[model samples]
Target: MSMQTSIALGKQYLLDTYAQVPVVFAGGEGMYLIDEEGKKYLDFVGGIAVNALGYHDAGLSAAIAEVVEKGLLHCSNLYYNTQAIAAAKGLCTLAGMDRVFFCNSGAEANEAALKLARKFGHKSNPARTDIISMVHSFHGRTYGAITATGQDKYHVNFDPLPQGFSYAKFNNLESVKALVNEKTCAIIVEPIQGEGGIVPATVEFLQGLRELCDQKDILLIYDEVQCGMGRSGKPFAYQVYGVKPDILTTAKALAGGIPAGAMLTCEKANEIFKPGDHASTFGGNALAMAGVNEMVRRLNDPEFTDAVQQMGSYLREKLVQLAALYPTLCGEVRGMGLINGMVLTVSPRKVVDACFERGLLVASAGYDVLRFVPPLIVRQQDIDKALAIVEQALASLL
Candidate 1:
């Protein structure tokens, strides 16, 4: 279908939630998307960091095709599936955690994590249900997850949010300390706040939280849904900080765009959930687990992960240069690994729109930051091209 036709159909039927750009993607090659009009645009957004290995992945495609041919798409939780078992083992090994509970998305993974936390809390005391989340942290859109999110904008019109969620200032140990008490069972944080403008937490802050959580017997939940899966150039962002959390929630890029999420817990919090406490209907189905197996294999490789770190440094350096060249238009650049953001003095949407017009796809993180979460497999030339397109887009604003 033509781009205009597809867009018209979408406007007629789809919800009016997103202010979508005027383009319809037909297919994707490595690191770029081909629009219905046959325009090649660099895919720096990576479908909001879902396409970790980029488009046209042979291994992932082969695995899915194999599963399709078997005609065993789902067997429910009643029967055992080899793919699910293997995926869980691989994820646990990579995460250095004891067990994993699979789900469909980041929000569901987080919801499972919260339930695990509350279950663990109630095991000791009935009233220990409070959860402390960072001030700007973006968890998810589910009732419990949205209630746990720190931003008030998402809370609007969703009145009577679930009780027992308090907000603490990001990177402020004092703010966290003030909100803590006997009722606080868990403290959820993003090692690097993704939607909150790609902000990274300070080392001292994370270490302090570790110490405080230990003292208070609180579970430290790192929402790695955005920064994990080799996006941070490390296996997980918490590893970069040399600290670990009691529980971790991850989803984006987990199954290479196959819609999978996992909530992993260390030994301390691993066995909190009984069979009847929590479960997902199609969480670890064979098809999704097939994708997970392939994706985890690629991301767990040392050479590939090292390249991600190197490329992240290269991308950050180029962004720093761009900021220096256009100080009036840009602000500070933040983030680690491939999930970086360029702060803008102007509205991020304006800059994103300009870049889209110039054959590049980017996204906005918070209110004024342009987020760049290219595929982990993006090459140096792709980075150079994306940088050039961004520079041209910024120059157009002048």
Candidate 2:
């Protein structure tokens, strides 16, 4: 279908939640999306860090195809399936956790984590149900997730939200300490805040949180939804900081673009949830687990993660140079690994549109930050091309 026709139909039928771009993507190859008109756009957004292997990856495609051919996409969580079992084992091993609960999205994973935290706390004392989240953090869109999110913009109109949630300043250990009390059950944070303009947590802050959690017996949770699955130059962002959480929620790129999420728990937090406490029907669907199995195997490779670290450094250097060239237009360049953001003096929407026109796909973190989360397989040449278009877009705005 034509781009206009497709967009018109979408506008008429689909929920008006997103202000989508005009282009209609037909398919994707390595590092680029082909539009309906056969216009190839460099995809630096990586489907919001969901396409970790880029597109049309041979191994991922074959794994998923095998699952489809088996005709066991979902056998229900009541019975055991090889795909789910293997995927669970692989994820737990990769994350260095003891057990995992599968879900369908980042929001679901976070919801499960929150439930686990509350239940674990209740085991000790009923009043210890409060959760402390960071300011400017984005958890997910579910009721519990939205309530845990620190941004007021997402909470608007969603009144009478779930109680027992409070926010502290990101990277401020003192603020977190001030909020902590006997009621605090858990503290959730993103090692690298993805939607909060790609700000990474400081080492001292994370270490301090870990120490405090140990002392107070509070469960520390890291939401690596956007930064996990090799996007952060490691299997998980918390590994980079050398601080382990009692529970970790991961999704987005976990299933290599397939819809999957997981709430992983260490030995301390593993036994909190019994069978009836929480469950998801399609949480560990065979098809999604097949994708997860392949993704985890590929992401675990040392060569692959090493390349990510190298390319992340290269990308950061290029972005720093871009900021230097236009000091007035851009501010600090902040990120770890491929997930990055450039603080802009002008509206990020204007620059994003200009980049779209130039056949480069990027996204904005908030109002003034341009987010770059290219696929892990993105090469130096692709980065050069995308940055050229970004420079062109910035110049156009000027």
Candidate 3:
């Protein structure tokens, strides 16, 4: 089918929610996506950092296929399943959390975390119901998740958002301190603000929050939906700073592109829910758990995670070199592991469009930042090729 025809069909049937580009991807091979016209484009976006194992991972594919052949895709939450139990154990062990509640998306994972915190707060005292999130943070698009988002632009036209949620400046302890009170139930933050221009929190800032939460008896939640699952050179982004959270949420690459998410809670916060508290019908199905099992096994490997750090360093060095070459356009390079962004003087949308036209797939974050979140399995040669395309696209702007 023609790309235009596909786009027109989408416009006719789908909700007018996303500002989609005109491209009909037919298939993906490793790090490249083939369009309907048989043109190959290097996939740096990795489905917005969801494809952790790259395209057509042999082990992951085999596991999913085996589950399919077994004719046990989903058996409902009525009975126990081995896949969910194993997946939960693996994730909890890696996160150092006591238990997990599975869901279908990052937004759902965050929503669960929010509800868990509220329940925990009320259990302690009926008046503790407020939550403090950080400014410029991007939680999901659901009602609760959107309200938790700190950006006002998302809150537009969606007034009457869930109340008792407030915002504070990221990486600033004083801002968080000013917002905390006896009624505050929890503070949710992204260790690395993925959508907020790839800003990372300082070690001291995270440590201070831990201390404050401990002193005030407030729950500290880390929304690692975009930065977790080995993307930050570790099992969880909180591990990068040697700070843990009372509740941790993760998705995106949690199941190697499968639709799955999880909210993990430490021992103190694990008992907030009972059997009838919350549930998801399609959460932790056999198919998703199969993918999660294989993906976690690979992600848990030391060599695979080390490669992510090494590749990220190489990519950062190349970005720095590009910044030196075009000091007028490139302002700053920030991020850890495989998630990085280049601050630009020009419009990021124009650069992203240019790269797309040149057979490179990248994304724009915030207003003036071009983000690169290549698959964790991306190699040195892929980085070189991507850098070349980025250089060409960036030079065109000048």
By summed lDDT, the worst window of 10 consecutive residues in model 1 runs over: 267-276
Clashing pairs in 3: none
**Candidate 3's residue-wise lDDT over 163-211, tens digit each?**
8999999999999999999999999999999998999999999999999
Tens digits of lDDT, candidate 1, 1-398? 67788999999999999888888888998898998888899999998989998999898899999999999889999888989999999999998888999999999999999999999899999999999999889999999999999999999998999999999999999999999999999999999999989999999999999999999999999999999998999888998899999999999999998999999999779788887899999999899999999988997789999999999999999999999999999999989999999999999988899999889999999999999999999889999999999999999998
Clash totals, every prediction: 0, 0, 0
lDDT of 3: 0.93
Sort by lDDT, best first: what order?
A: 2, 1, 3
Per-model lDDT: 0.93, 0.94, 0.93
lDDT score, residue 68, model 2?
Answer: 92
Q: Estimate each model's TM-score.
A: 0.99, 0.99, 0.99
Q: Tell how far residue 192 is off in model 2, in angstroms.
A: 0.2
Q: After superposition, which runs of candidate 1 have C-alpha atoms over 4 Å from their true positions?
A: none
